[model samples]
Target: MQSSCRKTIAELGPPKHPVVSARSAGRTRDRSPSPMRGYLIPSPLPTRRTRTFSATVRASEGPIYKGVCKCFCRSKGHGFISPADGGPDIFVHISDIEGEYVPVAGDEVTYKVCTIPPKNEKLQAVEVVITHLAPGTKHETWSGHVISS
Candidate 1:
């Protein structure tokens, strides 16, 4: 039986492989044009380029921001301010308004962002003061009507 199996094997041919012939060897290599070639890719002339984060935020500083008084009422003595830089609206109380300015809607204002403590509440804008009337806004002049930040 072993002799018959060997005779049958001898009649069969060897298996095909990539390295068997020059024609097959050509098929194994990539022939497409590469995008990296023949183009003037800019290299850093001075410093070698490094992996870096491009969208880092500014360093933390005193949270003073320019905003406008959204609403204010002498009776309620509380309102919210819309920040000019598009942050969340901050709560402001009449007591926070220092100097002689009375904040009103559309009044250009400056305030400091403060975090609420203890029981936990929304962030508040403290040291609220009217910076100036918004463009085209008019108000009767009181002494120190506009408070500078």
Candidate 2:
């Protein structure tokens, strides 16, 4: 029985690329369906696409909350916010940040929270706006210029 199964597998060879219906794949009706409809060719380049945001993030219907910038790395494109209500620090993404200057530690900020996708166990700050800069500290703008606060 095992030999027969192995023989059948060997006869089939390696599996082919994933198949999808022409209509679902967005093929126009002008193209005639031949040889079991049009083939959905996979991209030649390796796929490393990452989803930076989701539909939930775009909703932005949550109440605003105040926080302090615990630490932010412009190069790394992420940081944490210390909630004013004394809650645990929440993750902050660079894309979600608003205003001109990049956030620094102790900078007072206002933001809304959004739960991360997949597991949805962790929270991240969205629509972050710096209300006040940390006194006597230097801040950098998105344009690569530095300014003292």
Candidate 3:
């Protein structure tokens, strides 16, 4: 483009003007934490809690499944077992238990499969025998058996 100002450089050289910038305003960046700037420094989240799980077996039934008795009421005489065989919890009735052994929650038992033989049926445990009682069970002693919770 042709210069609109036909005057020579010597005539236009010195003019009244000063450049303004952050540096001129004393706000230049220095790569250091700024005291004036507000930052959302998130505090470390509260220490996360950990979870634990019981040693459960794969669900199946044939050659004696090992499981934990989820719970049983002496009066109700029935409870569920989470089998180590990786199968869903199977129902265990008092009739299935052998000998004088009565189990409580957390008690370990070994048992074989027994089908109810009806529609909407699920596999159940029969011929159950208490292999071990978990420590701290309510059943401390029964029929001279020192059972653990």
Note the clash tally of each candidate.
Answer: 0, 0, 15
Candidate 2: give the clashing pairs: none
Error of 3 at 3 (Å): 90
Candidate 3 lands at a TM-score of 0.50
Using lDDT, rank the candidates from best to worst. Answer: 2, 3, 1
Per TM-score, the best of the predicted structures is 2
lDDT of 2 by residue, 22-86 (tens): 76586434633232111211112111133344534453777899999987868656777899999
Residues 1-149, model 1: lDDT tens digits: 13242322124434555456756754555434332222211112111112122211111235568998876655544666889999866666555676565666788887765444332334666666677865665453335354343
Cα lDDT tens digits for candidate 3, 26-112: 554454432212211111211111101110122232477788886654554556678986777776666567656667777788887
- Greater-lDDT candidate between 2 and 3: 2
List TM-scores for all candidates, in order. Answer: 0.48, 0.62, 0.50
Best by lDDT: 2
lDDT of 3 at 122: 56
- Of 2 and 3, the candidate ahead on TM-score is 2
Alpha-carbon deviation at 34 in model 3, angstroms: 60
